[model samples]
Target chain A: GAGVSQSPRYKVAKRGQDVALRCDPISGHVSLFWYQQALGQGPEFLTYFQNEAQLDKSGLPSDRFFAERPEGSVSTLKIQRTQQEDSAVYLCASSLNSYNEQFFGPGTRLTVL
Target chain B: AQSVSQHNHHVILSEAASLELGCNYSYGGTVNLFWYVQYPGQHLQLLLKYFSGDPLVKGIKGFEAEFIKSKFSFNLRKPSVQWSDTAEYFCAVVSGTYKYIFGTGTRLKVLA
Candidate 1:
């Protein structure tokens, strides 16, 4: 794909439900990132992947948040026992290298009701 | 603990007016700075980035930002603005570990 693609542009889940969001990064991009953006706020880093290795996840909010980039290309962010505070826009981005320009996806808006 | 701060939460200007957005980061270590723009109903896009070159960096859409190491600031400026420039702007900082920390963001609205 020319740009990063994210699935489920919008999602509404009940409290305590589990939800999964997917991301397809640019072809052969070595770096992938996941972020969460609350309403009226900037995106916050959640996790990072260098190829298939999850090198950094210090920003993950809690144990309920888990992200995986299995083959270094596509990634998934799963939230277990979602809370109302978990409602936010989940963004996925990819970069050619660890330190370079990052291409962002449209983002998935998750609303936990 | 490194963090980014955007002073302005919202800005409104008329077309053809000059614009400036303030961004400051709290980090003493070596870092990279970036400015990103998010247009209406669009994903975030990189406007410009400052790595290890001149203090002044120019980006697409006639945007430029000056990195002042002493002040720990990277402020975005445009000599003249257009209606198309209306968008939400974000300032980001990347530390040695590659975690990109972003500011609160500023929403710009340009009236024709």
Candidate 2:
């Protein structure tokens, strides 16, 4: 597809288990972002990558959360020791550049039990 | 802490009603403002944006927004709304970096 796409539209994880969510941004997009959206709330910024370089990750909630875009096209967000609070929609967005409007993917909804 | 604020959490309106959703940001520097909408079971999509030049920006689905620098506000408006306009609207601000600070969002319900 031409738009951003994500895998496993839904995931349920047990406490202490680890989960990995994948994001495939639009082709040729130089800016990719990650966000977390809780029920009844807007998406919150998590991290951003300019190409292969992870530029800013100030919004990441914990050290256990890690994101990487080694090839600059596909990114992964991994969460270790899943907790109830970790249940939320993980959204990925990609833009032509840092200054352009981002196109989003149907987020992967993660549920921690 | 710099953040975006949306005035209403829920808005109930009838078809053909005029709509206005408020959004405000606490920032002093030059910034980019955007309004995004997410329909039921759909991804978030950009409605409009304000970077420079004219403050009034028109977006998809007959939606528009005005950027008021002095008030630090960018409110979305639609003259006549239809039932299809029902969705969750988010106001976001980007001061620097590529990341966006989004508001809690306003859920609008347009009744037919």
Q: Per-candidate DockQ versus the true complex?
A: 0.84, 0.84
TM-score of candidate 2 to 2 decimals:
0.98
> Chain A TM-scores, one per candidate?
0.98, 0.99
The Cα error of candidate 2 at residue B47, in Å, is 0.6
Candidate 1 chain A minimal-lDDT segment of 10 residues = A65-74
Model 2: lDDT of residue A23: 98
Q: After superposition, how far is residue A44 of candidate 2 from its true place, in Å?
A: 1.1
Provide the lDDT at A7 for model 1: 96
- Kindly report the interface RMSD of candidate 1, rounded to 1 decimal: 0.8
- lDDT at A113 for candidate 2? 91
True interface contacts reproduced by each model, as a fraction? 0.82, 0.88
- Candidate 1 lDDT over B1-112, as tens digits, reads 8889999999999999999999999999899999999999999999999989799999999999999999999999999999999999999999886778999999999999
CA lDDT of every candidate: 0.95, 0.95
State the lDDT of candidate 1 residue by residue for A1-113, as single tens digits: 79999999999999999999999999989999999999998999999999999998988999999999887788999999999999999999999988878899999999999
